[model samples]
Target: MIAVCQFGGSNCDRDAVLALRHLGFEAERVWHADGLPAEADGVVLPGGFSYGDYLRAGAMAARAPILREVCDAAERGVPVLGICNGAQVGTETGLVPGAFTTNASARFRCEHVHLRVENAETPWTAGFEPGEVLTLPIAHGEGRFEIAEDTLADLDDDRVLFRYCNEAGAVTDAANPNGSVDGVAGLLGEHEHTAVLMPHPERATLPDLGGTDGRTILRGFASEAEG
Candidate 1:
């Protein structure tokens, strides 16, 4: 079974789980404080204000016992994804290098923004076409991604992934909503088995919500797992 890590302060656990189930996977949520589940095939860190965003969104939650096990899982090449606050945890844990800071706006804002898929090779994005615009929801105070210039170059060369204009089919800085470095919304893991993104794809999993763009991303993950 796949395990979705859920911390006490994580509010989107159920949504993640629901999306996973919709995709026909057997998923379970494990508390962030507990050790990683022994039988997890993959792990997902859903979006939320773990510890109420105290001392940075995921700073305190990074040290939780479950995260240690998650680190172990990541090193073993288990597919893991961190979304929003979960993205912060991924950065803190070194699953994905760099960190997220308060948005240029300095306050939490929730709205739909356009996202262009810059990389279609990752498992989570395999179903998307390069340069596709996906209307996804973003709600966070800290979503800006910062990385060293050298690493940024490496990411570009390796196609680690990037966020682009959801409307113009272009990767322009102006379309960026949170001022993420390089207009990045998602990135591949060092080991190529993990993915972390600030946008909440899970929130857009159903047609009732007015969009199903996220289904492709999640479907890609399951297809890779099956393959």
Candidate 2:
């Protein structure tokens, strides 16, 4: 079973469960206070404005009681994927590096954007080849990734899972929707089993939504866990 954590303002909890189910995974929303189920084989921190975005987008949810169990699960090598606001929580809890901050435009951005798969080596991105361009939608006001210049330089290429790019897979400033440093869209955690990103993979999983590129990313959980 996969647990989709539901926080106070987690609007995407059900969407995540539905998306995972559509992909043939057993998943359900687990309220933040209820903690994780013992049978949970994977975890997804779905997108949304947790705690009304108080103090910060994901600050409150990152400190929630259930997060302790989530952290423990990640340490045990359980596949964990954090999207959008969840990405912020991941960074807040130190599950992933860097921070998602205010966009350069200082406005909420909601649109489909192209992403270049920077590394296909990690479990979260193994479905695609490096340099593949995927179309994914990003909706956020604080989705710009911020990291120290030196630290960013030290991250292995494999650690940078995805980067905003043009349809041709070129990383250009005009293609960067959020002005994230180096166009980073997603990153791997301390281990390949964990990952965080600002894009809404669940939203892009259904073909009816006009894109199925995200299915590959979510499929990673099933593939990795079953392996």
Candidate 3:
């Protein structure tokens, strides 16, 4: 069973559940306070407005009781996927590093962005071709990725995924929607299991909805969890 964590202010839990179901996985929403379900095979931290975006986007939500459980599970190599605010929580919990701060523009922006797969080896991006152009929606103000140069080097060494320009496959400000250093939009954990991405894959799971680009990303996770 795949575990989908639901927390106060987490608005995308249902969308995540639906996506997982569409991919034919058994997924359950484990409440923020409840310990992670014992039967979970993997976990997901869906996008949302956790804690009313108080104390910084995911700061308060990271301290939730169940997050500790999620952290523990991740240490044991259970896969975790954090999207948008969920990505923020992962950073706060230290399951993933870095923080989301106000966008360079200083306001929320919503639009479709083009992304190139920089690391296709990650479970989530396994089905996507290296350098593939994928269109996905991004809505956030504090999404820039801040990390030390050494840490960025380490991520590259470990194959942590990142988003690059669809045209040149370069990490630059133009391709970076939120001023994230090096155009970092996603991360694959050191173990290469957990992944956090700012773009909304759940929102683009259907072709009729103007996309099927997410099918590979979501399907890759569900397939690996079952295996």
Error of 3 at 36 (Å): 0.9
State TM-scores per candidate.
0.94, 0.98, 0.94
Model 2 RMSD, rounded to 1 decimal: 0.9
Q: Residues 63-153, candidate 3, lDDT per residue (tens digit)?
A: 9988888888888878888899999988887878777788887878787778888778778888888777788888888888888778777
TM-score of 3: 0.94
Where does candidate 1 have its weakest 10-residue lDDT segment?
A: 155-164
Give the C-alpha miss distance for residue 47 in model 1, angstroms: 0.5
Tens-digit lDDT track of model 2 for 113-134: 9999999888888899989999
In TM-score terms, candidate 2 sits at 0.98
Candidate 3 clashing pairs? none
Per-model CA lDDT versus the true structure? 0.80, 0.91, 0.82
Q: Where is model 3 more than 4 Å wrong at Cα?
A: 164-170
Q: After superposing candidate 2, which stretches have Cα over 4 Å from the reference?
A: none
Clashing pairs in 1: none
